[model samples]
Target chain A: MAESDPHPQSSPVEPVSPPAPATAPVDAEWHRMSPRFVFVGTLRQLRGLVIPAAIILITGNVGRGGSELILIGIAVVFTVLAALGSLIEWWNFRYALTDRELVVRSGIVQRQERVVPYGRIQAINVSEAPLERVAGIVRVTVETAAGGTADIDIRAIAQDKAPQLREALAAARAQARQADNGIAEDATGAASTVATETPSATTGGELLRRLSTPELLALGATSGRVGPMAAVVGATLQFGAEIMPESWWDRIPWQQAEALQSVGVVASLLFVIAALTWLLAIGSTALAFGGFELRRDGDHLLLQHGLLDRKRRTIPVARIQAIVVGEQLLRQPFRRADIRFESAGGEAEGAAGDSGVLFPFLPRAEVRALLGQAAPEFATDPTVPMSTRLPRRSLRRYVFGATVGWVVFVGIAAAVLGLWLHRWVDVVTWQQVLLLLMATPLFAWLGWARWRDGGWVVENGTLLLRWRSVSRQTLITRASRIQRREMTADPLQRRVSLASVQLSVASGLVGGHYGLAHADRHDTERLLAMLGGPRHEVVIHKVPATVEPS
Target chain B: MATNTFDAGEAGTSRVIEVPERLPDPLHQLDPRARQLWRLGSAISGAMFVGIVALGTFGAARFLPDFEMRWAWLASGITLALAILNAWLSPNLRYRYWRYDIRPDEADLQHGWFTRTRQLVPMARIQHVDTRRGPLDRRFGLASVVLYTAAGPAYIPALANEVAADVRDRIATFANIHDDL
Candidate 1:
């Protein structure tokens, strides 16, 4: 409950007292980031200069001859400033590990001091971007239950020191947890074994799933990013046309290509753009998640992946709140859907901004095996499709739910194509308007598919629900992890005794809530009882309070 | 300069922070007498609503030269009919559906007329509870208890003063029971 405060991160920093400035003996145990940090940091800082530098080099050269000198001067100033900032940051950043907490002190002016107790640390992430990797340094981000925003980021540390620090922290945390629980002497031997000689634990732990080259390609090919990427490329093309020299535009063979083919220029351009965007999407996906691997350590799952920016995240198995299996419109045809964990860590990413994706592309049949191996708790029902589906009576509601949007869309489309434009009477015929209505059968089929796919099952302290739009999404969450449960029935659904149940969990920056429509009234009650205390009978104005009435 | 972050160490963290002092028990108790109060409130609101609609449309009709006075009267008449029906029927139905049971472990609330909602909040999960009494609520000797959890807030509307005090204290006790108090 205390963790639910929107500004929970403030507490961790609040607990830390002001550090003794320029103190000698206290600073003896202080650890500084690797010197390679400055070089990498400066390069990162210079990234902001790319656009301005490019503008000066290209556009400035269009009318003026002094572009090179201006570019050089600006580059020098930027380089110097970036280097100075990184140098100052490196000099100021210091962290010390104590028996009780890991204390970090950063910033020279608006100093930020954060103290995270070993017991409070939720997960640890050690990553190396391309430059950091090249420099043989890694960035360590220590996250508490307060989530990622309140992270103590050690931008660069020598790769060798990371394992020692992690082992030390882990050992201390285990001790704290044992002392805190006061009953974990049974697992004492196991705890000590992992904490002691585990510098190479990243790769040495039990292997779960490693996305093969072909599977990686499949994931890239079937990704939903192509749609968004096409939009981006369209914008980029417009920008390109604006910036290009007049001579370059004149040299193009667009008219030649348009004249040679049955397809118009717009259609041919769309085809080329589609292909380019798809290729870009694949390349970007590969760059982001090339060698994805899920490895398991005791009480924790370590995921290591990425080609250009190598990342390793240690997610404690206990922290996982829910599991989401998503099937894209393209991938559902192949019976493949990506798997994601809605862990209590308030990050929608693992974090690739891909919704906590553990397995990028997994076959529907094999998802159970992967979850069983990686996270056994969420892998209760393999089919995920075989849960308690909506009743046959709810089919009409689903059909109506599906068509309400279509009706609105068709009405709008009719207004635009058939009536709105006065000049397009001949081109945009009433047949086209009727043609759009032809998609009603497809929507009706969609409604049928939704009815077929929608299901909810509550058993074994886990809640499993499957719902779909164009793409299917299946959710598996433990009862105890649910932060909130709500059941609602609109006026229409009330007539048929159908209800909607929603469950929210502490995920992402705030939280993520998922729900299913048109569920049985009795099922929602069962769900309410899933994580609740004792169920008393309906007592209206009878049960007295702690004391007798006056 | 403080070298250590926390001087009290770990054991003292379990000390009670949210609930500092226990409240005195109330000598007088009363059940929620809210049925007539609720009906009167709705009836008043319905009358006011009809009056406003009649005045607003008629006012607009007067201001604009081409607008029809008959249409405004017709609009006001329709709203008046609907509001009278609602004001007569809904208050009792709402009171019937609203149910709240606060146990030592969890607080359960089953309410809503059209879109029925059931919220079961565990005592441990209760962030805070607030009892509010408005001017109108005081006239009827009624109060509302709002229970805030990490996820969001749920409310038990229109409770007697003594009952609200009792519910608040019981929730505080149950919540503290989860911690090492």
Candidate 2:
């Protein structure tokens, strides 16, 4: 990908402003991104193709049949096109730091040009992959208020340049803010000229206080089915292979067998590998993001994470749509907690922002403290913890309904499987049928556990609602962010004076929900008041001065 | 010193706001692109029909059942021709009608070389503004000013570089003046 010059819309010769002075501090406006940025980005993009290419090659070989020559030629063409595309994409990608903006120009045919004016850029994130670390290159991604979709990555820059660029962007943003605050006449020229050099705020060593290897191992071990599931499947497949005749293996060709291996040996091996791999991945990820801390960098919260990706997310404090604090039964044993915030950006797994796992595991106390510190306004009354509400008698109905469904499913499966085996081998007996019948109680018990955990609590402006099954999710969001609210009561619930209230938020980030079912009218009213539901009447509750973390 | 710059500019203020070409509302502004897409789609469909005819009339007559691969060249030529036509016609037709006007407090963008659109974005609503010049823009010394708000970013394309700079500064000035409101 050849770098399309900064702005194809205007000429380079057009006078915008004079270049920065040589004496400009190292911590100045924007550090010119490395020339090798395209090379590194191209490499990163190509890395993703490796897995897909392997899949296509395997599939093509299997489907080739008698036309092996044609298949081989097609594969060669595919490889060549992919390789050429990687090169074209690499050549087309270019990033630069002008006095006014951080510019990224990329694309093969229809070029996309992203301009992050220093003032509007909220975050500068530098992430180092294991391979990049070896290459002494890090990816510095720039995030702006525009959204995460256009976040620009200046790839393969020197490790040293990451901090410098981050600082430069920060200072540039600060200058923009200064301009906005009426400190400067020309928001443009004056921002470029205001000279100040401050060393980038170094991430303190306190972040290293994250979980130990044992703690991480314990977390991964607790309630993780992938490992045990793999072990069981592996044992089953091994048993099957042992029982199957050699003729069965001979009848299936090698290509056919290899394709099936993913569901067979590979699937089983994944679990075995996942058990240890998850432990290590979690530990390393925690270490990298441990002591995860956030601070106000101008109007944005500057976040630094990673032992490897070493990413920084500059999220505008105001763009935060909602906040969620999650804890699982497994994490309960260790008293570890996961805290995530939903921000207006692109989607990511495990968190709201495009960056995954904002703060994966922290102590319950730490979660509150961090939320309070990071977003003080939204985290009003940090001392006041949320009140808990558990589902009442009506929960029994929900549980019973769930059991009936589960039993019906299992009953159908057992009847069909048992009938099929009866003619050929010994079918499942009455004892097996009785055991299957017992599954209703099992499902009911699980549902009851979930109902027992579900509740809603209003903490000043923030609403904390907890929902749980095997996996637990607790969401805490601001009252104003709720875009819409719905109150529903079933015939059973109405008889028992129970209602379920749901709140919708703008955008899909913190789903438009937090259903509080079968609570007291006073409790429901309290929720309605917090949501500013139809009545607009709220009974403010006063709490004791003494504070505690639950 | 900062106050001095504002004080100096106040004395030379021009009240007669120049209403240049206006850009339509966000949905309307995309009209040109939408029309182009419709045209391109129809063209491709028409080409497909023509391809069938050529294959039957000429391809079967010449290449016959053996050298039928020759149709690939015809398809590639048609596709490339369409692509070149799209690049040339789309931007040229769109900007020809997109009208913009910058006032002291807000920007009124009216556009639609074909389907008319009008949008009024208050200066205060602009969270930030970005000015960019592409290769084509550079040749004409034209630039694009993108005004970003909480909803999304809107573009004012094909302004002269100096004019773009001036408009950006003016918008920034308005944003500051009305920020409290």
Candidate 3:
């Protein structure tokens, strides 16, 4: 009967009430976030000014005498101002859940209010950072279908209240959708439906997958982008050299050192660098994805992971535009691949590892099964021979495009060195020229590889394009997600009746454009037609007979 | 290959559906005033170039001992020749090649002289449409219709002022977009 109360809002309004009964009519009333939000807001404001304050203090010390106190006073004044701003922001912010939309009113100076319809919400993420965890609170972010501008972030809420808010919002969305579909429901019925749909810890979800510690370690070991690590190591060595005492350098006895000893020292240095990079990579991966678990709740996939700061991300399957399966060169031999998603609306830009990854490392064999279980619409026969490889003629084009310019530039440099510097033997030896000539064949092989790996396949309403630059990438995207279509051909491609087809799809900050080069002209036309272009008719011409012959 | 003859109602009257080799209608070219706008812009740029060259020659002659003014003059003369050629030729070429077609579902644009690029943007994907007029464009009574899609914005440049506004409104209508708060 409590669940069936039609006019919950009719109850007497109470301010600052503790956790209410499950059937309470708090939905229509404005509610301030958890009181702990003040602390979160203050910290956030302080974090923004930390670097500036540090710079001020450092410069104050270096510039003159007794200016330190003045700089300290300025820093204190800045802190007080920021704290007051945060207090005002916290005071002005209030959120209310109406029947149709979530209305958030906030802003001290601008007087801003955002009314987000429940039906438009794409996903809700509840994350607990280290500080929030200690404070016994969580941060909730609501994303809507209006792309970048429509996201709403609630900085701090009690941990227990988060799940309730999520459930309430979800039930509201479902009711709205049902109402839109012509389901006439009384207020009591809607209330009862919401009560029934509210999910508890043990209900409404099925565990799909979880990553073990060993798997996480493996993922870290095989993680891509070693170049950054190398750069970091180089920078660290340079810094170390600057900080080290002169005696440390003299201790190396470089004047009397033998070539073998120097070589050993260099080898050990490389070893140390590699070991440190590996350790750092592993440490970071474990921290980010230590206890990863993916669960399914109706149309949403809930992913929770982290070592220190737990994050719960709800991804609506419908908003996903594409799925990319990437296999790094080092991981390919082990038959492991990383899976990422291209979702339509969320943060415009995100950390490389944070936003898109569905899973970091999965055995290649299991990718299809995983996709089937999670996103069945994208599932297809992975072994199907639907891909059409680039033509042999394209190999020459690739080679010429990739290497000819560099080869010619090197040739000119060598010629200049030989003629102008009169140092052909020292600067541009015959061996060097031979090496430059050999690059042609080497680049030809690379071009052949690229051609072999490059292909496009259409199946199950999705276009799967596979291409190779440094590492091979396979992009599987639905045709409906494509925003634009372009067929381009240079003079050379036109002569061969070849064209490149580019499909623009909503992704990342600016959107992503993927192209399949050297596709047949007829195939490109067919692709256009498939993408809802005008239907084309083929005409046959008949030769006329001469009347004089009769 | 074998040819089969089918009977026709009238003794040799045969009809076949033809897939046209080119677009059904010729592409709509930019407004002719676009050429005048380009020429004005080029002339301003040429004047700036001449000023820079004159200043550099004067500075070198006054400051440097071994500086030869003839080489500077020759270089400046070559630049002015190129500028004049561009002013005379490039506007015509650009106007000839820039064409656009706005259909109910999509907009197709083709432009460029030597390396032509064609783009097709579906109406449903257009996020916003705007009409922009620069100072020179305002004097010429011309504007550009810029369509913003998720991919990026595309411009149909140098249309008559009213036409640009009309095109923008048409695209907005076709896209079925209404501003929402």
Candidate 4:
């Protein structure tokens, strides 16, 4: 059993030699799991895979008896198998850290085993949830120095035994650390002195800091996703009625004013549907934005909330790859924002669809403070005023987009109206064409607004790109963290000697094209050179060890 | 003066150094029973693949949809040909490419055929090292050594005995020495 198992304390301990280190050993505590952990973890795991599979199977055979029966049988088999697997996992899973080695044993029939020497243990993380809090249990996750997918997770371990496990792990870690630093083997004399005074506990008030009604409202307002989802739903519901056979398509007449009067009934029904859709969308938005909070715990940050399936994630500050600050136009008034961290092997569904993320939301101030504590030099000081805004060259692209949009709108309208009315020649009246001609300027205005907000900066080995429509987002990342960088100029942009830059990082993409219109080629070249330099120049200093007081 | 970048062109000049005493691949010292088990598993897997292909080809002729039969045949034939070619060529290729050499500062690996690859992994860059044995490796008294860097991973196959310990110690030494750096 892995030490992360709920019953890790019960596992047999193995003895091994400690590697010598240069530094005096610090008392360290690794972690063990709580016994109840198996129950909760197995339940969560069951929901994650089986629920969706069951839903898909049931939906796929909604009306069929034979197929539905087969799917149900499969679902039942899976559930039974998963339950049996969990029982075996709970019974068989074991982990423990002795002075010498960290041993993990799992699997039912296969009886898999992993034994990591104390010298090879790298990082250890401990996490707890509200449920775990009530039960006095915590999860201990250990990362071995060995690469590959061989992480040890001990679920549902007793809270009391956690310190013992932590001490063992920490002792090993300290030994490893000392060895890395070239300290002597007998250096553990100072181990007791390095013991942490602070307990692994969160005070009640600290928990309250995560959410208040007003903050949740602000989070809702700043949440950029809600309005877009609402608009899509409303639009779909309104158009959905028209696609049905009951819409009475034959009553509409293009030639006479009486056609408008005849379609009034359908129009009213569409309006009512739209209103209902708007209400439902608002409800969904609230549900998504409800009960949000962010807090810090020791060297880790704890983010916990959920309208359903309450989740608590504790991430070590060092593991954070990058921080992104986003603002939607509606949230601009309050300077409300969402901050997400890029993490490795993220569990969220959206990451699989788009990119990996650790946390999806946080206040702007909290984000800065967190970054300042972790990789302080990497986060561009938020107080710094953006030196450059949109350039005049952006107007060209805006004009281009606006022109294309107007042409497409007019073309579609002409084709639909001409075909339906049987009057191809006179389908577009002079007034409609004039309206389209006028809309080009309106679109240009909107486009100009979008471009004006875009800006970029390279500071302290960190790259910052802030862009928005009505809302704005500032993305900050370490240069060493960047996985890929590309600069490209379109044909027209090339003619104008303007280019855009994209930086890809482990978390995802930080992208914005600076339209360097009036700047000389030399200026663009200098900027690119700086952007492409080694990572140290961006963030000069690592984050301070302690969190700053607000 | 600092050593110039490693040059394969100066192969003659690249003096042979004694192999590390605690190398990572010395697993052949393990009892013979383990080795036989490893080889047996590999043979079983290869036989299973052959059996599956034969059965699939014969069954596919009767069960495949008319439209898909052509594509199936083409794919199956290609797969079979590749499998057979691999079975024929793998031993020679493995023997030709297999080598582990340690310089004073770094480890060097030479492998691959059509596109020969030579890797010079600086001791400083390695995050960790691992030695592993599969069922097949157990049978042949062979083991594979893997070196991991923050950037990526490299694998060495069919190492001789007594290499695993040496590689692991050297890696641990390097990791410890350069951790902060």
Candidate 5:
């Protein structure tokens, strides 16, 4: 394997032999991470100064010779200072693996140390940026089960040593699990013993799915990042217009052009904007997930992808908090969906945002098969009638809710015409009233569609909550993963005996909450009862205080 | 108060566990000193508002030729009215509505005036507990207990000092959250 080199140039300490025994000492000597980390750290510090440097250079008074020289001197000083600081940080940072914990000591001025137990490690990711790839090094990020951001990030390490570190950590975690099980067995004789099998220290894994070039291109084209791309393009265009030459505007005929010609210009501009946005989105997606591949290795799911910065993310199946299958407005008609995992720790590599997208784009028909193969635990029986649809009474609620905004808008227009403008009868024509009236059916249709798509299902200890706003999403998660369940009713909902059931899971920093809105109160209660039904040992009760005569 | 018991059927033994009639606890008021804390907070905000009004009046007198004092009076009157309401009426309403109870396996919180909310945090999901004392709380000999779960942190504000510490300790013990964890 490419990740098992014996002679690493960066490490100051000799590499510890593989498979450290389960009974290793509690306090191990600290070892510095790869010395190449100083380079990575310097790069990170310099990255923040790029825009400032560019601005300084662009706005510098080059005509005044001394001022330009001063600016260049200041830039050089800052670069040197940043490099020195990165070197100091690299000197201060050291990490050690104890018997049960990974201890990291860092900070130059005020010393700080963090200890993460092996049992708490949720996932490990190995990624390389363009610079690190050039240096033949990788960045390792360790995520704990704390459900916040990543616990620690080793910015740079030799590519060959990354896998060895991962293997050692996995082995420690397995031993910790065995120790925990042994203690539990001693406490309760009836407790079943868990197998103490370590993950195989090899690269081979069962290939579950791989995206081909054509499919990858299709994914890029259908990515749901058009909105962000459009914003970026709009900002860029605004900036371009500000910096554009005045002679360019003078060349165009503004007043003499025909109305049709102006309209044609506007239409072409819109087309250009849309095309640019589409091309940007596709190019970005292609760069991020060009060679996406998912493989199952022992108990971990390995994801490898990226074009410029090739990356690998290993996620244990047990750490996944929820699975989100999303169908965007543009891709639904073409029968495509995006699959994402909400894990306990930070996002996996190449996951553009907080979403740990396993596959950016996949055929809708094959989603079930993929889920069955990749994560069978989340797959439920398709034939079972588990969906509890909202009633027709709820449709009235939805329509009223949807149309309230339109009502406000029309009321404002009427007030302006009748009171301020005093053109009530003359300006408010029947055609305008008809156009306003048309919004009612449009809102009603939207309400009906939302009600049609919204439903909740519980099967095999997993709850599937499906809802739609602009796009439809079905969140599938184990009922046990839910930390809290809430059923709330506003005054209006209470009048209709409708309530919203919200389930909070331990995924993201604030946690992920999925709500099934406007469900019947009885049904919500039934669902809550079902969640608490299977637990045999513990039953909690709230005791009301007895009122005393005052 | 009613008791509902459900019987668990095993091969030879049948055991019944008593369940409460309601899923939430009966309303329990917060510390009486919370009213004083609320009043003090309102007073501080009211003082800041007065200062701002004074500054605005000075700015207008120096800068503008035709600055009406009636608008300033109206704004101050509205601000005072809101401050008075928050200082006097809101505290009572909040105290009446705010209630919390910690069970062996879960914690139930019911609060809010117009839009009532009831939240439950299972003990098993609790991550940590903290007791916070701000300046006013310290003056009033009161504290607030914050319970952190994986989802987020929820606070029980304006409890007596001893009660806050006791609640924090009890929750920490119940959740099995050690200092190191």
Candidate 6:
């Protein structure tokens, strides 16, 4: 990225600060982002055309049978317009470090200015646009705790300046907090610890774990991310088939496929598709987390990753609402899990204000050690073969819940395919259709396992709820951080005196909800009562008004 | 929850689960006039839906001269019947189920008979509060107190205007969270 490039020409700007800004002072000159920002941004906008342009060249013609020159003409017009827009946007962009806030002003048609208070700043990250693969530019996204959106993004800055600007902002934030708190040092150090990617481990930070090549590649192969990519690729292929000519359909080796049916050609095709998906997963995972490093400096966890983008994230240990230990279906055999912690009201799965996955792939046994040095709050390990499992009566419900739906669905499919479809077009043989019924036992077994795996416990104020579907997920959260608790039951459950409890903890735009279904009503009620649920009428006079409303 | 009378993890050992004597009752209810508001709201929306169905029926007649208005009539009949039923029966049942109480530390809510649900939102978690009133609601002299927490908005609907204001105040006064996180 351009941000990573050394900027020999750019002079270092002095750290400037006055008092806490009330609004904008007319006399103060606002600082402009890098001029290179504009050039890279324009190219970034044009990046979408690369695929189309390459396809057009390879095809050697324009279609819908349109003229080649006309296509190029349209492309040239779009390119010019995009470049002009980028240039104008860059010219209007301005930012300044106030005493307690970072003031940024930018708009195309509307005059917009955002003042992000340093205290509420969740993360100030150095990220690259997914398309800015070759471009040396970077994006400085300022995320606030207000919501899971990037409040301010300074796009396309020189690599070296990222560290400098981050430090200046940090220094101002420290001063601001110091004056605000009337203390020289706060435990949070909120923004005092400047977000830096230049090897922060040397500065009072402990390096926890850095994934090696074998580990990173292994993580890629087993990661749950492959499923979505495969779906996307499948969708794209379907779309492509719709757009392609009839001649394209003639290229397939269907006769060979039919001949190889006895050799389980369908299974082999599925295997091939799975392998391709695995390969794609590895490539994307490596690119995303090539040199993933986990470091802890007092109350914050610094994450440095992305082979190409070179993104860095700092998560305040105190802000974390819940930590998730998840074992994907493929990774279960290896006894590996990914550890990620969600902070309150921050962006999901991306470069800015990311749900911090400190250990993208780790041996399940070592999670305790990692949690101890990292976040001791989540160090309470709910053991395997949990003793607090759901009641045995709940087994029938779980098994019925999982199996009934699938059995019905499969039954309907078999009827449609074997009886109706075969009558008209011999698409599926009765025996072949009947083979699907074999999956019912698998579904039933999964349901039974889910019941066995479901467990909940509250110990030392840390609530642990464990459940397994296709993947096993164990959520560990502080009781105090839980924003709300919910218990629900249906008529059937009412008869059995069973209920489900869902606890919501603040994470991202909407809080994350984790729950266990079919817990005994008594246990659910007990759990709720423990988590501050009122069992008896509460006296209104006890809590003195905490705040005087304006 | 503080009782800790039993070990919860011992559930799988075939020990009998003690059914509690009774669940707590969030007995404090909404304003009696709130039912009229919900009824009016449902009726208006139902009327609009019937109007749309009638329009669709007429519009289709132009394209398909042979098109019978059977589906439209059936749909309109169902909508009106459901609307009438809702306006008559649901308002009372809903009012009976909808209950909320503001405790010192949290707000307790219970509703939905078929799928009973109870929610507890902590006082510290409340980010802001608003008293919302629509024209229809205003006509009925009812308002809703919405509590916006970091998680999401929790709604306590169909309160008297003055009562809504009081509830909003109590929630707002308690929700002034100063945490930077």
Q: List fnat per candidate, in order.
A: 0.12, 0.02, 0.15, 0.03, 0.15, 0.24
For TM-score, the strongest prediction is 6
Interface RMSD for model 1 amounts to 17.3
Q: Higher DockQ: candidate 1 or 4?
A: 1
Worst 10 residues of 2 chain A by lDDT: A535-544
User: Can you tell me which runs of candidate 2 are displaced by over 4 Å?
Assistant: A1-209, A223-318, A346-356, A373-391, A419-430, A490-497, A506-512, A518-522, A533-550, B1-181
Worst lDDT run of 10 residues, candidate 3 chain B, spans B3-12
What is the DockQ (computed on Cα atoms) for candidate 2? 0.04
DockQ of each: 0.08, 0.04, 0.10, 0.06, 0.14, 0.13
Stretches > 4 Å off in candidate 5: A1-204, A230-259, A262-280, A346-354, A381-386, A391-393, A400-444, A532-550, B1-29, B46-54, B57-62, B177-181
Name the runs in model 3 displaced over 4 angstroms.
A1-206, A260-272, A304-312, A346-355, A381-386, A404-444, A518-522, A533-550, B1-26, B45-67, B177-181
Q: Write model 3 residue lDDT over B47-121, tens digit each, in one string.
A: 798779878886787689888888678777888888899889998888777877665556777787765566777
The runs of at least 3 residues in candidate 4 whose Cα sits more than 4 Å from the true structure, single-residue gaps closed, are: A1-173, A179-282, A291-321, A326-337, A342-378, A381-550, B1-57, B63-79, B82-128, B138-142, B147-165, B177-181
In candidate 2, how many Å is residue B27 off? Answer: 32
Candidate 3, A84-183: lDDT as tens digits: 7666566656677866566565554333344555544545677889989988999888754333542577877899999888778767756654555433
Q: Give TM per candidate.
A: 0.58, 0.40, 0.61, 0.43, 0.62, 0.65
- Give the per-residue lDDT of model 1 (tens digit) for B1-181: 1111112222112333231122111122123355556777888898999999999999989998888999899999999889878877777667656766665556767777777776666665554455555556656656567664434566777776556655654554454321110
Clashes of 2: 32
Candidate 4 chain A has its poorest 10 consecutive residues by lDDT at A535-544
* True-vs-predicted CA distance for residue A125, candidate 5, Å: 21
lDDT per residue (tens digit) for residues A1-550 in model 6? 2222121122234222222222243344467777776677778789888898888778865555668778789889988887887866776567776444566656544334454545445456777765443556577886544345565789866767778877766565555555555545442343433333432433347888888899899999887779887997777767896899888668777787577667577678678778877788889999999998888887678888889988777776767888989888788889888898877632223322336687888889888888888888888664544546788889999899888988798778777876778765557656664687778888899899899889887776888889987788898888887888899998889899899989987776777788999998888877887777333344322211212221
lDDT of 4 by residue, A216-316 (tens): 55555445455565677767865775685744655646467455557686698667755555555545545754565556665555665667656555554
Across A47-104, the per-residue lDDT of candidate 1 in tens digits comes to: 9888887766676654467756776787899899899888778766777775556656
Candidate 5, residues A1-550: lDDT per residue as tens digits? 1123221234444333221122112448666667777777777888999998888678866657588778778878977887788776776566678765665655543333445555445456678999888777887777644446556677777889888877777666555545554433222211112233434423558988888888877887777778899999999998897898999878868676556457687898899999999999889888889888888877777788889987777666656777888887778898888888876642233121134887777888787788787788776532233478887779887777777767778878876886677642346655676689777877777777778788888876788888877677888888667777777878778788888888887765777788877888777766765664332223322222223211
Candidate 5 local accuracy as lDDT? 0.66
Q: Candidate 5 chain A: worst 10 consecutive residues by lDDT?
A: A185-194
